[model samples]
Structure formats: structure tokens, C-alpha cells
Target chain A: MTANPKGGRYRAWGLIVPTGVLYAVTFGIPMAMLLSASFARFEAGRTTPGFFLDNYTRIASDGVTLQVFWNTVTLSAQITAVGLVVAFPVAMLMRRAGPGMRLALMFVLVSPLLTSIIVRNVAWMLILGRSGLINTWLMDWGLISSPLALMYNRLGVIIAVVHVYLPFAVLPIYAALRAIDPARENAAASLGAPPWRVFVHITLPLAMPGVVAAFTLLFILSMGVYLTPVILGGNFVVTLPMMITDVARNQYNWPFASAMSVLLLASIVVVVALASALNRAFSPPRND
Target chain B: MTERSGSPFGYAMLAIFGALVAAFLLLPLVILCIQSFTAESFLSFPPPSYGTRWYRHVAAAANWREAALSSLVIAAIVTPLSLVLGTLAALGLDRGPMRGRGVLYGILISPMILPHIVLGLGIFRIALDLHIDDSLLSIVPAHLTITVPFVVISVGASLQSFDTGLEKAAQSLGASPLRALWHITLPIIRPGLVGGGIFAFIMSFDEFIITYFLSVQTRTLPLEIFSTLRYQVSPAIAAVSALTIAFSAALTVALMMRGQVISAGRIVR
Candidate 1:
């Protein structure tokens, strides 16, 4: 690469200044405000500006909030787990498919992600609601006498979340699967190891990086989910973000909401750190 | 190496599993599209009759029209603003001094992963204190925080594969920097630009949570659909949802036709 003239270096940096300024105004200042507000006190249904750990303390002792937090964590884990199971086979298929087949598979997966979350959830409501497709078909076929309690529950939320996040799970695993040298598996096969054994020993270990990455990504996204729970869960299921929104919007408890937001952000940080540590622990030793 | 993919049994299992997963992905959208054509008032599978009555209803509703207009206006503003900002940030990251590049890149892209509800809560507080809560003044900036990351990442992907030699050659021939960039660099990165632009537009259009926090009198298309869905399971919503699906599907096709403008991996990453 040719060295740019001295003036060009500064110009290159200058290009970033606009975005930096935008972030400062939009993201940076607001986050700072949120952090400070989390320390403020709320009493008698009014928020007073001052330093207090009351909000954080409430998160621990208030009892209801932490349950919802745990519920959110459990739901996120469930979605991530289910997503990995379904996505693994699809990723494997993508790795083996021809270019045309791969593109078609990518289209099916990515199109859902690009579609509006509300639209996708609405579609799910039509498919899973009382008079929706599955129920109607079941009743018509005499398979059941009544509609299943499919929508408006944890199961519906999991199904919808998993559907949306499946692509997130598949792509990374597929990338990792493609990155693997087939020769390793072939070598294992030539040594008289069966296909499933080779997969267990070679493919699964090699694909761990992508699997971990997908889990991290899915869990993070699932934790932040607000609309899916509201729409698909019929507001019967409350996640962390749903609680934060309810507090801030309906209750007007800005400090409490801000505190919850901080907690959510902290949990995300922990997840990221844990995932990276796990990635390091599970990584195969490099040969080169 | 290629012949060692197990027996026909394994292939059959994978194929069956893959097809099932694909069906799972497409079933909702396909069902919604079919349900949108129902002539009946409420949602039901295998709709009693097929017609465009809901489409007519959506077209006739003033609130739907207004929300769609507001979304378009906001997306119209957000698209160009974010594209310019994101491209500049991406360019700086690619060509700038090689110090803290990773940190800077992470910071720029952090908005993508940061929970929208948290960001919405922060923006809501600030907007309320400023008394600009329900206006474009607050909403536009909120949209920018999220959409800019897509542009940065997508454009950054393009810039990574870009060759600097052509620009250097143009400069050596006495072209000014701006002239060389306009004539050489812009065309080469057009695919990224197009992809990033569509991404920004769609994101701003579909954004719900932050807009929900910021808007009281103002409603975007998704907000309208959400409110409607919350209160009533109307067939008109199916029509609106169908339109949105079509909008995304058409744009996705455009990206595909643009020939590897952005991959699902790059976008997800």
C-alpha cells in the first residue's frame, strides 16, 4: 500500500467526526443521563434527583423485579437452546449444499429477519391463535375437540423468538462449518471411524466457535426483546425490557426504569464476558 | 474428501430436517399473505372467502395512511443522513491511522446490539425534559443511533475489499482527491451504498420500541399496526402486515440482484 500524503491522514480522521458528533448527541449523552438517573431516588410515586442506591436495592429486595429478571434469563436460555438445535441441522445442510441451494436457503432464513418484527409476530398470531391455522385444522380433522392454549403463553413466545433468531444461529455455525477443512473429517473416516463418530470428534469440536457465537448473539437479542413478548406472549409473559417499558411508560417511574436498564446492560456485559471466556476455553489448539 | 459425507441415510435426514426448518421460516409469512385476502371480518384459517377487501380497508383508513406517511417521511430523512454518516465513519475506520481501530469500530457498531428498550428509555427521559418528546426532533436522532450501525458495517465490508491502487493512479494523473474519490471510489462501492441505504430505510421504517417511547401523537406504520394488533385482531392488519412483508421481500430481492451486495453473515455480524 502506498503511503498517503501527510494531509490525507488527518482528512481520513475528519471523515469520522460527523458520526462521532451524532453518537455524542444521540447515544453518549442519553446513556450518561440514564446512568445518573439510576442513582436518583423514587418515593411517593415521584422521582427525586439525588444519589441513592434505593433503586438497585429494590431490584434485590423488591422480590417481584428479580423474578421477572430470572424469567427473562430463563426464556432467553430456552430460546437460545431451542434455536441451536434447529439451526445446527440447517447449518450443516448449508455447508453441504451447492451454491444455488445455499442462496435459496439464505433467502428463506434472512427474509424473516428483514421483515418487520410486528408483521412476523402478527403472522404468528394468525398461525397460532385460537382460530388460527393449527387449531382450526386440528378441530376440523377431529384430532382435537377444542383449540390449544398455544398463544398468550411462554410457549408461543419461545416459538416466535426462535423463528426470528434462527437465522442468527445458523449463519455463524454455517460459517464455522465451512471454515473447517474437510480433510480432517476424511482422515478420521479413513481411519475406520464412522460418520457419526467423525462428526462428534471433528465437526462438533471445530464448529464450537460458531455455536458459542450464535448462542451469545441469540441470548443478547432475546433478552432485549420487547415487542415479541407483548404481541406473541399476549402481555402474559414479561421479560426484562417489557418490565422496563412498563415502569417508565405506564408507571412514570423513570428512576426505577433507569435502574432496570442499567441492570439489563450489566447482565448483557456479563453474558458477553462469559461467552468470550467460554470461547477461549473451548477453542482447539492452533496447529499453524 | 468430498465422497465422505456418510451414507444416503445421513443425506436424507439432513434434507428432511433442512426442508422442515425452511417451512418453519416461511409458514408465518405465507399464512399471513393468504389470510390477508379474506373477505371475513376477523382472522380465521382458510378464510371463508378470498378477496382484496382488507386491502381496500387499509387504503381507506386515515390513520393507516397517516402512519405510513410519517414512517416514510422519517425514513426519507433517516436514509440519506445515516448513509453519509455511516460511510464517512467506515471510510475513516478503513483508511485512518491504525491506532485503536478495533475499539473505534466496536464503538461505532455498538448501537446495533445495545438493547433498543434501554436506548429508548434514555432517549425518552431526555426528550421529555427537553419538551420535544413527540416530535421528529427526538425521533430522528433516535432512529439514527440504530440505523447508522448498519450502514457502517455494510459499507465497512465493502471498503475492506476495495483496492486503493485505482484511486492512487487517478491521483498520480493530477486528479484532485475529491475528484478521484467521486470518479473512482464511489462507483466501486456502489453495491455497499445501495445495500446500506435499503437497510437504513427499512430499519427506520420498522423501528417500534424507541418510537413507542418518543411518540404520543406521532405514529409510524409499525406503531399503528402494533396498536391495532394489541386491541383487535383485525383482518386489515393482515393486509398491512402483508404489505410490509412484500416491501422487505422486494428489497431483499433487490439486494440479491445487486450481486453479493451484503451477505446474511455480514449483516448478522
Candidate 2:
């Protein structure tokens, strides 16, 4: 520690300045503009610079947008729930897997993340569309006379989204599971505690942090989903982001779009805060 | 890694469920790859016949080639720029003043969690006001907003396990501070750098939302794919998806071979 050069601390701090400048220019200023634009007046598709509450008022009174926002929230919760249920077993199996098996599992989970979202969704279209593989095979086998309404609806959107986001949920829970001390579980087992009881009492509580993390992340990521609902939802399921894009791009109503963005950001922050608070309330006291 | 000493029935059920989830993860991609080789012009699964015609179509298509090229160029540029910025930020947060380290770390990593739509709209508004909406000048910076966070995170993780003593020993042995860092520190953290760089390239290359707002005439690969999918479901998209999947598969192998650079524990940390 005594090998420090003169003013090393100053120079060390200086290293961050470049990125700081870049973030300030790229994110900070634009965010300020977004906030300001949210309050600006918009009349007849023309965004004029001024303070106004019409945009917020419209969102509050416009029953359709609220419904869409609620739909987005519900969709996010459903996706998170499905993701957690599917991912937990995979994570457990991963923990029990050999090194080679673990690497292969990681490959399966992470490769989907590396591919573009549209590409993944395109794959889903081929699988889940009304005339997709499932429907085609079912019809061919005479299992059903008609193609199931598998896609072009909310179910399709949820399926495709879950496929894409499942890894995001899995990775954290797996990490959490891996971090658990093996001795505790062994001790519980040695005490004649049943396997199910050991899991529910010992392992599950320890992994709550990871579960909470996964939930928060999946929910946030899901809330911002725009492309999936558009491509997979067949435009039938309108989410908040889709509505914002429509308002901004097609309607040329920047103020209104900004207002919606504000709403989306606010909701995300609120939900994340609530999740952390609930975790705090329910989590057993940490030994650390 | 605790072995879950579950009941036989429970173990059997868990393994079955796990295998099914794995298959579900791979099924769409396998189907899409199969569809890419169809002999027919239209999109169909378990194709009546197989051919490489769609692949050849994508190869010969001018717009597809241009879009792919543009995406590569942007990724190539954004990769190094974000790498340097992110590495510097990580180095600073690791070795610099400790007064606001937690706050700084959170700020640097926040972009990764922020919804892309809000960022896209914000940048789009800025580009419009500055009249630079349809150019690389606007798009590159927008891409950086998201990509830099990945570098900071991955590189920071590497730094967390780094041995500061090596750099100190070098300094004590008469190497300058900067030289010690350059020789002793950077080489050991190369895995993190490589991992972060790969993430940066992929993120920038696959980035669609911000670029969707910023570009009109200059279409990246994802933008091209989006527009193509919007118009009609074509076998050509299957070809493109297959190619991207192949590329990702290759990257995944490369990352795994690098020995846990993208490990779940490191990422969650």
C-alpha cells in the first residue's frame, strides 16, 4: 500500500472523468430533455415548449392507456412467474450437474441471450404460430380438425417472451443456489429431516435473494418489451412501450410519448422498490 | 454444489422437467434452422423438402448485405470505444477514491437495467433537435449508452478477484505505477476484457431500439430484420436467424472455453 506515487489518488479519480463526460452528454442531458419534454405542451401534433399538465391528465383520464399499462404489468408478472417456475428446476439440476454438464447447460441458456431478440422471436413464430409446427403436426396426426389459436394473441407473446428471458431468470437463481453452503443441507438431512423439508426450510430461504433479484430483473425487462408484443402479439396485445412508440412515431406527439415514458419509468421504480421492501420484510435475518 | 437428496420420485420429476425446459429452449431455434433450408419460397416447418436456396437468397440480397455490413462496422467501432471507457471507469472505481464508490458503481451500471424504449425515445428526441437523427454520428453514442455498462460490470468483476499485490510488488521493484499496471494488471485481467469486449460487440450489433429511432436510411441488421418481419414472414428471415444463431453458438463456445468469464456467479455479483 505504501508504493503509492505522489497524487496517485487524484490521477486514479481522473480516469473516470472521460466516461463521466460521455455519460453526461449521452444519458444525463437526454434524460433532462425527456423530463422537460414531458411537461411541454402539445397541440394538434405540434410540440411547443411550455409547461403543461395535459399529457399527464390525458393518461390519467384515458381509460384505454391505463388498461394497456395494467395489461403490461399483468403480462410481466405472468412471465416472471412462469420463468421462475421453469427456471428453478433447471438451476437445481445445474447445481447437481458435472462440470461438463454444467458447461453444456450454460451454453443452452446463454446462447439464446447472444442471439438477437427478433431472431429468437422469429423462431417462436415458426413454432407457435397457428400454422406453426405444433398445429401442423397436430392436424396431420388427426389429433384436431382445426389449427389451435396458439399465437397472434397474448399467449403467443408470453411464450416467446418467456423463452427469451428464461435465462435471465435462471442465471441468478443458479448463482444463488451455487452460493448456498452444502454443509447446512447435509446437517439438516443428518438430523433426520426429510428431503422436502430440508429444501423448504433450509435451501429456499437462502435462495430468496436470488429469486427476488430474478423477479425484479424479469419484471423490469418485461415491462419495456416492445418488439415481442408487436411481432408475436400480432398487434393485438398493446403494451405501454408499443403505445409510446405509436404516439411518438406515428402520431408525432412527443409530449404525450414522454409522459408515457415517465409513467413507465415511475412504475418500474415503484415495483422494484416494493419488491425490495417485501424481501426485506420476509427474508430471515442474515448471519452476515 | 450441494446434491439435493430429494426423494426418488421427486428427483425423477425434476430431471424430466429440467430436460423438457432445455428442449423447449432449443426447439424454436432448431425449427427455425430447419425452416431456413426449405426448398419452398414460403415459410413452413418440417419442410416438404430441403434446400439451401434461402441461404443463397440472403447471400445475394443487396439490402441484407449492406445492413449486415453497417452493423458490423458500428459494432467494430463501438466495441473498442466502450471497452476503453468501461475499463477506465472500472479501474477508477477499483483503485480511486472511496468516498462515493457505491453510488458511482450503481450509476455506471444503471443503464443495463433501464428500459431500452425510454432510452431510445430520449436519444431520438435529442437527435431530432440536433438534426442528426439519421446518421452514425447519432447512433454510435446511443449504442454506447447501453454497451458501456456491460464492460464496466464484467471488467469490474474481474478486478474484484485481481491481486493488487502483484502490481504493488512491481511498483516496489522499480516499475512505474502506470507501467506496473500495464504489464502486471492488464494481462491478468485479459479474460474479463475479452468477455466484456465480446458482450459490447454483440450488444451493439444486436441493438435495435435506439438505432430504430436514430436511423432512417441507415438500417442495421436488426432494423432490417424487423422491417422484413413486419412486412411478411419469409424464409429469408429464417436464413438470417439461422446465421445469427450460428454466430452466437460460436461465441458461446468461445466464452465457455475461456473458463467461466461469463459464469453465472461472476455475472450475478
| Maximum-TM-score candidate | 1
Q: A12-33 in candidate 2: lDDT tens per residue?
A: 8677888888888778898888
> What's the lDDT for all of these models?
0.88, 0.86
DockQ, candidate no. 1? 0.69
Q: List TM-score (chain A only) for every prediction.
A: 0.96, 0.95
Clashing pairs in 2: none
The residue-level lDDT of candidate 2 at B266 comes to 53
Worst 10 residues of 2 chain B by lDDT: B260-269
CAPRI quality band, candidate 1: medium
TM-scores for every candidate against the unseen true structure: 0.97, 0.96
In candidate 2, stretches whose alpha carbon ends up further than 4 angstroms from where it belongs are: A1-7, B1-4, B261-265
Give, for candidate 2 chain A, the lowest lDDT window spanning 10 residues: A1-10
Give candidate 2's TM-score: 0.96
Q: Give the DockQ (2 decimals) of all models.
A: 0.69, 0.60
User: Chain B TM-score of all predictions, in order?
Assistant: 0.95, 0.94
